[model samples]
Target: MLAALAAGCPGGDQRSISGKVTYDFVPATYSATTGTGTLAFAQASKRPVRNAVVQLRQGSGVIATTNTDEQGNYRLVYIPEDDSGELSVQVLAKTSSPQIQVEDNTDGNAIWAMGAKLSGTDAESESGTTLSLHAGHGWTGSAYDATRRVAAPFAVLDSMYTAAKAFMAVRPVSFPALKVNWSPDNVPQGGDKASGFISTSHFSPAENEIYILGKAGADTDEFDSHVIVHEWGHYFENNLSRSDSPGGPHGRGDVLDPRIAFGEGYGNAIAAILLPESLYVDTVWSGSGGSLTAFGIDAETEPLDTDDPTPGVFSEASVHRLLYDLYDSGTNESSYDKVSVGLGPFYDALAGLQKTTPSMTTIASFITALKEQPGVDSAAVNTLLSRYNIGPITSIWGEGDSRMFPMYFSVGSYPYNGTLTLDGGYEYNTWYQNQYYVFVGNGSRVTASVNSTYDVALTLYQQGDVLGGSDKTTSGTESVSLTTQNNAIYVLVVTGFKETDGGYGISISITSP
Candidate 1:
């Protein structure tokens, strides 16, 4: 009997099944094979099924197994691992093929034909593509088709779009209807490209695009989600400040400005809050190597240096640490700081306004209202704080710490005595800890001529309550006079310095006209 069964089986001793799957009337593409084909089965009841497991079973032993593709077609291969003789096939949740016997005949054609006839009921209509996406209100451009040849089941694109729309709805401006394209090539290795980004022109509005890697939900990652949201955050900030200073005096562009730190931080925070499950998977997945902490940061131990620069707002490491602290096991003082304290109220105001107003239109209005109230820099902080609402942020520095420290200034001296010539210099002091400075005035256009008698050293910190100075040096007498176009303030401070002399000093002078 076993020999007879083997003789009747298709592919003879080799056991394999091939067919196509479809869901909701759409053909499902196989991950291993990119081909699409129609399922030809004699049975009509077993055509469309969901979550049905398809497998090749030999006797009681199950061989290779795979679930039906979303479109109800599945292919199963019988590997050498399973005994090849009498085979049993089954269809799930349907009465059609409770069990079917296939003989592994010496000539495999019969078994192959027997296996090929397994079919399912068709549950979906063979309808044409009628899906349409609208570019809601405040969208500047007309809709454009963004279809491309790529892997299917790109659900991440949908998630990114939903998040972006939600975020924009809360803002006070109209977001443009941007076309999105998904491609493995365009998908960034470091972050998701769906988050919106602005064109390079300093004043140009942001361009809208979303990119996704076609993969199963299990294969999709979290960085892409976070990055896409972060880009939207930039859009909110830029649109809010359209008429304000281009980049602010710091020279950092809209995205990099220190004033926008709150915005960046908020973006990350919102990403965390909304996608907590995704966050858990990314952080806790054993595939991630067990180093990911609850806050989605690497917690592996590493060496540290005393002189390393403190992480800035843009530092991924620093931002991760701060976020970890904020979202850690329990709340602490940092949670109630100015930035943290104001975030909740600000968010509440924006939410309330969003009910009656469109986001793009009302974002600026809501932000303006929040700024005019109290303790907020309406021109800068309100827009950012309201969106992410981390609460009040503690002042960046301590009390009595000079917010602005002077680094160099150009002024003529009867005797120019300073080792630091037209170039810049540094100063250090124990009292200057937590102190930052503003270097005011232009140094390049000093007008004073060479002189020996009158000596002058550029003052480091002069205006604020904090009194700090760099060591004096008498290198040569050169009357350096700098012409002032307009008084410009350059701020600096020892982010980190040794306490040896309480402070070290290097000579620097700003020449005056």
Candidate 2:
């Protein structure tokens, strides 16, 4: 259900006020090829503040209240008694939604608002009375004035409204409560959330909060719709689908952990799909708010040729491009991109097979699940996979791909040598930095060991659920023992902390007794 808005009483001497709300949105100019762009206040665009609460207040008491429609238009009717108090229109940076609240994390977590005074005489002046209120970006040609910067929170709220609409378009949703913390004091520094050092603009699954970078003259995401929706995509995946990604720093070109690539790329793809355009722009400010730079990319047209050098299943660039091609009704540059399943079918895969698969949520798992759904074009989908060199998808475990990709190792092969090494340029968070082994538990205790010069981290899981493992900080032999169920499949992962000091050598073994 939406908000419990008051139904205004209209009878004799019905006084009403109808109006529209709008905000200033700055635009960015980007290079389609390199994704570099510029943004300035001079090019600000006016956009609607939709799905927000609009109120007509009489002095301190509220005479009538209503919600803005999709176009930021609202109408409120109130009966006139004695002209004892003044009337004003107040708009809050909150939605009666699929409830999303944009709060000032630095200032008591309060919802932001701006007001316009309305006279009672004007309320009943005519049959169709209207009022217009707009929020400005507060730029004074040289710099920004914080007091006049009232549109930032409203801009952020609009993105969430767009995301809710995109999801509800496909199916009815009873969206859970969500809080978005934003403030001019929010920065990338790590500290208490109240002080506004949010670490970064990201969605925290632990706190169930999305923190947006709001420090001026550094980086602010209020105007960046893609960044907002990208984080929302994370929340959607966390709430609805399954995410096995070990979150960390990732880029478009780099090879990543399979789970991370799919997660990040899906975030990028969701922004492209839900936003008004396919272009994704993330803006950054220099030492002064007057100087702004942005990075833009076209998810629908980015190419991944056969000769491109990077991780195949581990490239977020490949993941987003493929997903955008699948959903958008546009022509793609990739020769293998002939499939268009749209968002509804794409979502079907996420809420269905992808959620329940035994394997970690990777592209292989998602694509395999997507193909299993009804009415999806299988042959065309395979063409796209073939271009990326992704193996044939038949199972959530990437059926028959281990021969070439070697994603999984067999527990039957004892005294196995792991091939994952610590390269000087490689970070420890990537898929190539770890090795995985799978085996069926015999309803008995099983022991696993990894011998290495550096710290060896080992984690065990059963059907995507974490069990228990060991990751000793000291080097030598890292071993873990655990009991397993009969015929239940279990996966063990080993990551080396060599730090490019030596080879990624470590004999691994798993035995049941």
Candidate 3:
């Protein structure tokens, strides 16, 4: 039973009305493990509903209007001094505009206000009043229609709205609106089959779509606020920030490609910051009356912080924990984490520096961006950086990195010769072996070769686009020859026949007849 409040004004003095908006929520179809049979809505629960517009009115005319913030609170001020004190508070019928309901392709019932009530006060005295709004719920027979009608999609929208508002708060800009497709079979065809909630959501820039899981039991994701925000975070990176991430399967403690590590870690870290809660949980369960599993971002269970034994610069877990350590006031009690800079600095780094970094978007580039911010103490920044076994903050190229393997050490100016060890850890994200970059002049034909006792292969690439490769046998040398068109840079990769490891010599020279 939520209502709007109308305060009284005396002697032409100004008056105000303020209140919070909350909704009676029912978890239509939620699973902690696997979603089975017919999905049923959970019991009614209450939570704040944000971004609804509220108005203070007299008779048929409006005095002032304001919209709720992320917390679902709003205030209307400067009402004319009404001697009669007769007034009413109203919640606008439409909570969102046409442009905002991109996901609801059918009917766009983006949101609905259940019902509204009004309160009146005696004339002549100036005082303030408060009230709340109770939102309504309805459903259509179609599964897709029902999803858009329920709290899951609304919750996802709310979380994304909260994140978008956070970015605009720091620097105002027009945020791109997109659709979120939530259904049991929302994932791509031939994609991994989900048990309950697909556990992952992906953004397709080409289609401008985000498909979420609405599968009852097997895998649905509407109720997982962090997962929603995390997916939205990816959308932001793809839209606003530069994502050079080689997209693939990744998770905690994985030695990912640096690009993938930063991109995924940024998403995970920001989700925690947006919620700012003590725990980041992803619950899984079976069908109705089934057992439940709660995967909390608890240090003891998912110890991703500095204490992680396999702390690699390439670890997504390390990247996520590092970003969280930088943005949150919470501490793991092992280091100087009290220097939490919160979301302002983190957002600044993401939207400002990381978005346009010259190098591949990696943790090194991210740290470089953080250090360049005015008034940021490099020492304090390094203190947190060092905790993850990364030695120090030097160049954005990640030079002098004693912890991470020397994977990207350049081949220097070409006509170049260098010796590299193709050790077992040289594999990047389970695909590439060891890749190194070199420069070549336009119209130049170059011979790139690798010599080693172990069976090795050689590949040539220009800015990640493979030019050519040569893999002859499993116990000798390999080489490839290509002519450059423009003044282009190239990358030389060394890999074993079977991802083996050993000493290798690489050479590149301008071809001469």
Best by TM-score: 2
Question: Higher lDDT: candidate 1 or 3?
Answer: 3
Clash tally, candidates in order: 87, 0, 17
Q: How far is 400's C-alpha from truth in model 1 (Å)? A: 6.2
TM value for model 1: 0.33
lDDT-wise, the better of 2 and 3 is 2
- List the candidates ranked by lDDT, beginning with the highest: 2, 3, 1
Of the two candidates 1 and 3, the one with more favorable TM-score, higher being better, is 3
User: Model 1 segments beyond 4 Å from truth?
Assistant: 1-160, 167-169, 176-182, 187-223, 235-267, 273-295, 298-509
Model 3: lDDT of residue 278: 36
The alpha-carbon lDDT assigned to residue 169 of candidate 1 equals: 52
Candidate 1, residues 106-146: lDDT per residue as tens digits? 23311211121222221111221111111111111221122
Q: Write the per-residue lDDT of candidate 2 for residues 167-189, one digit (tens) a residue.
A: 78987776778889889889888
Clashing residue pairs found in predicted model 2: none
In model 3, how large is the Cα lDDT of residue 107? 24
| TM-score of every model versus the real structure | 0.33, 0.88, 0.65
